[model samples]
Target chain A: MSALELAAAVFLLAGAGFYLAGTLGLLRFPDALSRLHALTKADNVGLLLVCIGLALLAGSLRQAALLLLVWLLALLAATVSAHVIARRALADGAEVEVRDGGGP
Target chain B: MRLGQRLVRGIVLYFALLLVWIVLDGTGDLVVGGAAAALGAWVGLLVAPSKPVRQRLLGALAFAGYFLVESFRGGIDVAWRAARRDLPIDPHLIRYRVSLPPGPARTLLAGALSLLPGTLTADSDDEGALLTIHAITPDPVNAVRALEARIAAWFILPREGAEQEGPT
Candidate 1:
């Protein structure tokens, strides 16, 4: 494969890894709020990486810019939805595990 | 907002929608594109009938740079924690009294903070006075306060009297 193609493949793999990590976080986190954190952060970054990889393979500037717009929209949606879910969890008075110090 | 300013904002939004339509539709058909863009802009204006927030271009660029770097850091940090055998999360919720006034700026700050490292904005009070955030780190209060300062700086707001202590 060409260098560009190889780079795209690497990015795609990294993006998939992030998405997997996000899912793992969702399953592992103790509460709804923490799960939201894991999902939003991982998915946003994953989408960003995927967008970059696809943009590199895109035929034209317009297509690349459109891919970026998609990433932006996804980021906005994730942020809004995460906030909404967290708010609902808070309102429900979900039990959250509180640890005092920074993790090792 | 002034009528003229609103009109200008609407026009700008209309053109932006047109550009998005062209990019997505991938067509050079002017008639359909123009009609759709106009309709979309009209709907947007109805939904959010206000002048866009004024942003300093340089400040916005700086904020974007900071945000991109920090978000990546945050993603890696969480990924590492998820991958470990023993989860190292010290999850806690802390209330922060927001210093920014009630407006788009405060909303922007809240949204941005949610994406930053080790912090997730859980809820805010009805009056928008206190924000309850979930953090995986020990010093969530300090982390959020630092981010708040960056956001305030990004919006070009003066930070003299707005600084306040975190809720205990």
Candidate 2:
């Protein structure tokens, strides 16, 4: 593959790795709020990186702009949904239980 | 601002959405795009009228820079903690008070804080005066404060006495 394609592949792989990390945090984190942090922050960066990679591969201005728009929409959705979930979780006292470092 | 000005804002929104629709659906669908844009602008006006803030273009550019760097850091931070065996985390919540008025500014702020480093914002108390933020670390207060200040710079906020009187 060409060097540009190679760079795109690197970004795509890194994005996937970040997505995995975010999912790991979602599964292992104790409470809803912490999970929200993982989902909103890590996953957002993951999507952003992936979009960049795909835009590079597409190599068309229209497609790249569309990818960017998709990422922006995802960011908006994630931010709003995370806030909703976090707010509800807090109201339900879901965060009342906190165990530092997975203590027994 | 009067109702007439809000109508003007709606017209601007209509054109903005029309351009977006044209980009998405192409020039062949002008009629559909125009009709949808008009409807969208109407709905937007009813749902949320534009609140005028003294926008700082330079501050917005600075904010964009800050957002990119912090979000990149945030992802790496999460990836590191999740990958480690120790799972080093000290999760807790704090009520971070904000000076921005109770409206779109605060909503946007809450949306932004959730994407920042180790912080997730929730509307728990104080009716937009305070944010209930959850952080994996013991103290994200300083980071949150810095972010808040950055975001605050984007707008010339209404003074204490002028807040009650809607957008001027």
Candidate 3:
């Protein structure tokens, strides 16, 4: 594979790593709140990295610009979405049993 | 009103957008790119809603920050669930009122909801300001609260006014 392709692959892999981390968090966390937290961080970072990498590999200006635009829009959407889900979980009566009344 | 103020804002937003474009595109010609951005912005203004963009802009940024943190946490949770080899999810339907109320603010909230994982807007009523969200996991209360906080923060809407008890 070409050098650019290699870089793109690395970026994509790293993005996948974030997804893996998210999945791991989802599976391991004891409650919904914790799981929601994991989902937001891993997926958001993963997507951003993957998009940037893809943009780098993209051959045309228009295509790359479109990609960036899409990435930004996705970022905006995801950020709001995570909050909504988390709030919903809380609203649904998910108890926070393990807190020391402070940071973790 | 003044040329300079409008020019400066336009230039700043243009640059922000252009940088994204350049990164996505392998090459850039300053002249052609500048012309294209100018044309694009002009078109953007025409097509954009008549309402002011400032509120929406601020709301969008706040939403972005909120999403990043939540999705990260969500990813970890998903990972853990997979490792356990059990799908312990208690999916259910949740109906809640949207606070931002009918306009750009409301639209932003609706659009953002679709992107979040494990939750879907099952139904919406334009006049009632109600949204029925389907959540994949057990907890629905927190999900609605999170929605409330995020919408309030982004749109600067008052929670007391926008808040309504969830439909049971």
Tell me each candidate's i-RMS in Å: 4.9, 7.8, 10.3
Model 3 Cα displacement at B32 (Å)? Answer: 2.2
Tens-digit per-residue lDDT, B86-120, candidate 2: 98877886766565676666777788888988888
- Model 2, A1-104: lDDT tens digits are 99989999999999998899999999888878888888888999999999989988985676787788888899999999998988888779784533231111
TM-score, A chain, model 3: 0.82
Residues forming the 10-long window of minimal summed lDDT in candidate 3 chain A: A95-104
Q: Which runs of model 3 end up more than 4 angstroms from their true locations?
A: A1-14, A17-45, A49-70, A73-104, B1-13, B56-63, B114-117, B126-128, B156-168
> Pairing residues by index, what is the TM-score of model 2?
0.87
Using Cα atoms, each model's DockQ against the true complex is 0.44, 0.40, 0.14
Compared with the true structure, all predictions reach lDDT values of: 0.79, 0.80, 0.60
Query: Quick one: how many clashes does candidate 2 have?
Result: 0
User: Which of 1 and 2 is ahead in DockQ?
Assistant: 1
Error of 1 at B133 (Å): 0.5
| Each model's total of backbone clashes | 0, 0, 63
TM-scores, each model vs. reference: 0.87, 0.87, 0.57
Best candidate, lDDT-wise?
2
CAPRI-style grade of the A/B interface in model 1: acceptable
Clashing pairs in 1: none
> Over all chains combined, what TM-score does candidate 3 have?
0.57
Q: Considering lDDT, which of the candidate structures 2 and 3 is the better prediction for this target?
A: 2
